[model samples]
Target: MLSGQSFMMFVVLLCTCAFAFLNGFRDASNSIAVAVRNRALTPTYAVLVAAFFTFVGTMASTSFGVYLVSAVELGVPDGIPGLALLLSGLLAGGAWGLFCWWRGLPISSTHALIAALAGASGASALLGNDGVHDAWRMLAGGVLLPLLFTPLFAFAASWVLVIPVTWLVRHSTASDVNGVSRAGQAVAACAVALGNGLQDGQRTGAMLTLALVTAGAAQPGAIMLGPQLLGAGCLAAGVLFGGWRIAHTLAYRLVNIDPLRGMVAQTVSAAMLFFGAMLIHLPISTTQAVTSSIVGAGTNQRFESVTWQQVNKVLRNWLATPLVCALLGGILYLAMHPLVS
Candidate 1:
């Protein structure tokens, strides 16, 4: 017979896996959409490459996981209540991700996860004398700031990079330009995939680690390789199985993706993500970065070709994701509090 703590730990691991899968499923397009859209790689080949790189990138670093666990202080009670809180947050985040995937909306899973955790923490705090001040502070500094700024930075950076590059290569023959762009797209896609793996992979790993600590299976400072591998593998599987609908939305609906534009946007997005992960130590959204870069590139080359309607819809989804997931997480925590308490 399993101990009660063991059972709760099992549930937490399952929820973590599910959350990782949904994260990969919904965000896979961020790494591959440009390459597929530009015909630099077939859809099947792009997915495989993206999966492989995602795995490699995830295994390469655990810094983001460390930051998430240390920085975000959720004031939930430890043990069973903590497990319940984690499960609730994961469920809320995963639900929002699946909903967005179904609707072909490329919203930020990062934001959903952060907001869900915030909501659950807030709810837990409410049950005691403490308010959600720490949760709010962490949410604003660790999550919201990055979410707000990175996309705008990517947008401006992509526009600046594309305009000059386009002008410099304006005199090149069409075939030459196409060939160079295809090569660039391939390389940039791989970079984006790697970045996604590192940032998102660490996030899921951190969640699993937190759960393990709560269950007494691991210490707070310890990050087990098994859970990290499991998270990475599940993420790759999600990339392989899901992502077409959101890919289409990102690749075709928001802006026309030519080989040159695709390469530039992908490269810029990957660079921004890498900078954030390494230097800033922030877990920025690859989805937002990639999509905004694509839009920026399009706007620079041919402003009229960009579809503002689709862009607006995506923006709305981005804005709504955190709020919706927060509410869902709060409701779930409230419902589970009685049982867990």
Candidate 2:
């Protein structure tokens, strides 16, 4: 029979894998929506391409994984309470992702998880598990700041890019332009999928490692290859399943996008994801970056034709996601603590 701590660790690990699947299910559209919209790739092929690249990216590097583990581990207590906190956080994030996916609303799984972790940490602190200082510190520098800046930066950058891209291709024939744009969209879509894999794969890995360490099954800074590969496989499976509800919303409801515009939006979002992961060392939401970029690029040509109602709805959901996940995390942790203890 498993010890209480060992059993709790196993539960947390299972929850972390489920959370990763939700992340990929909801965020897969960020990469394939535009490409599919322009007929650059059929829906089936798109998912396959996305799944392959996502797996590759997840296994690509552990830099972000290490950073995330360090950032989150320091915040919670060790042993059973810590395991409960992580489980609560995972459930909170996964719940929000499912709700949003059902409603076809684009949301940031990364932001939701971060908010949920912080809230669980806060709740644990309230019960005198420990203080909230470390959790607060991690959220401030990692999630909140990126939440504020990434959307605006992605939008502005994509909007401006349309101008120059249009200018360069102005003289080209329509067929020629479409062909080039289609090709570009295909490449950019793969790049975005790769980035998403890198961002989210590491997050799930970190959570799993945290659970093991808290349970005394592993040591700090000891990341095992088996867990990383398992997380990546789960993520890739989710990508293959795809989130067509969200995909339709992004492809048609949010904006009127041509091949050129789709290419521009995806390219900008990919750059931001890479820059965040490698250079600035922050997690950027694939949903926020890609959705905002599409809107920005759409508005460049005919602002009136863009779907304001849909834009407003998506924005409202984006704002609500973190708050909802945080509350849920706190509530779940409080509710589960008594039983676990």
Candidate 3:
């Protein structure tokens, strides 16, 4: 017979996997949105390439994974309460992700999950758990600040990047520029997909690692390959499932992006992701970076072609994601307190 603790751990892992899948499903478009819009690659091929590169990125490094575990582990309670908290946060984050996807809005899963965890931590404090004190502080420094600025940085970088790219090709014919940019966009798409895997892959792996430590199956700071592979596989599968609604919103609704602009946006976004993962050890949203870059690049060409209403809608969702998921997580944790406590 399975022990109660083991059962709880199993439940947490199951929720984690489901959340990972939903994450991939929602974020799948981040890498390929601009590429597809510009016809750099077919929808089918774009997804396949994105999935492959994402998996590779997920397994590439653990620096960000280690940082995530440390940051979040500080806030979670010990033992069963911790497992319950994690479960609640995952459920809340995953639910919010689906809601946004259904609405065809791309919000940051990274922000949602961290905010959910912080909310669950607050609930734990209400239940007299002492580990919740630094939750918000850690979240602010680690996730919020980075997320807040990433989009702006991506926007500026992508917008600036186009100037140099265009200058180099100034002498080239329109056909030449389009042809080169199409191939460049394809490569850049894979790069962004890889960066997505690196950042998002760490979130799932860190969550699983935290659960294992809570369940006494592993030690803190010791990330295992099994969990990494599992997280990568689930994420890659989510990418394969594809989030066409969100993709369409990005590719078709947000802005009109040519091959040149698309390539620059994707490349800049991918560079930002890599920087966040490797050097800064922050979990920035691929969606925010990619979306902002696309818009920024598009604005440089024809400001009228960019859709402000759709941009406002996405921005509203971005602002709302953290608050809504936090409240939802707190509610779920309070509801689960009776059973777990």
TM-scores for all candidates?
Answer: 0.95, 0.96, 0.96
Which 10 residues in a row give candidate 2 its minimum summed lDDT? 64-73
TM-score of 1: 0.95
- Residue 66 C-alpha lDDT in model 3: 31
| lDDT by residue for model 1 (1-341), tens | 99776898899899888888888887889988878878888888988999999888877757453345331354444578778877888899899888889889998787788788788887877787232337777678656787789879989998889878889899999889989999989999999999998888887777777788777777666467987788889888888875788998988899876788888999999998788788778878889999999998888864477989989998898888878988998899899878877
Instruction: Give per-residue CA lDDT, model 2, range 1-341, as digits (tens).
Output: 98888888889889888888888888889999989989999999999999999898888747554246442455557888878888888899899899889999999887888788788888887887763347777777666787789889999999999999999999999999999999999999999999988777887777777778778888777457777888898899899999999999999998888999999999999998888788777888889999999999988995454788999999888888778888999999999989887
For model 2, name the residue pairs that clash: none
Q: Rank the candidate models, highest lDDT first.
A: 3, 2, 1
Q: If both were scored by TM-score, which would come out higher, candidate 1 or candidate 2?
A: 2
Better of 2 and 3 by lDDT: 3
Highest lDDT model number: 3
lDDT of all predictions: 0.82, 0.85, 0.86
Tens-place lDDT digits, model 3, residues 219-322:
77656788888999999999999999999999999998889999999999899888888887777789999999999898888457789999999998888888
Q: Extract clashing residue pairs from model 1.
A: none
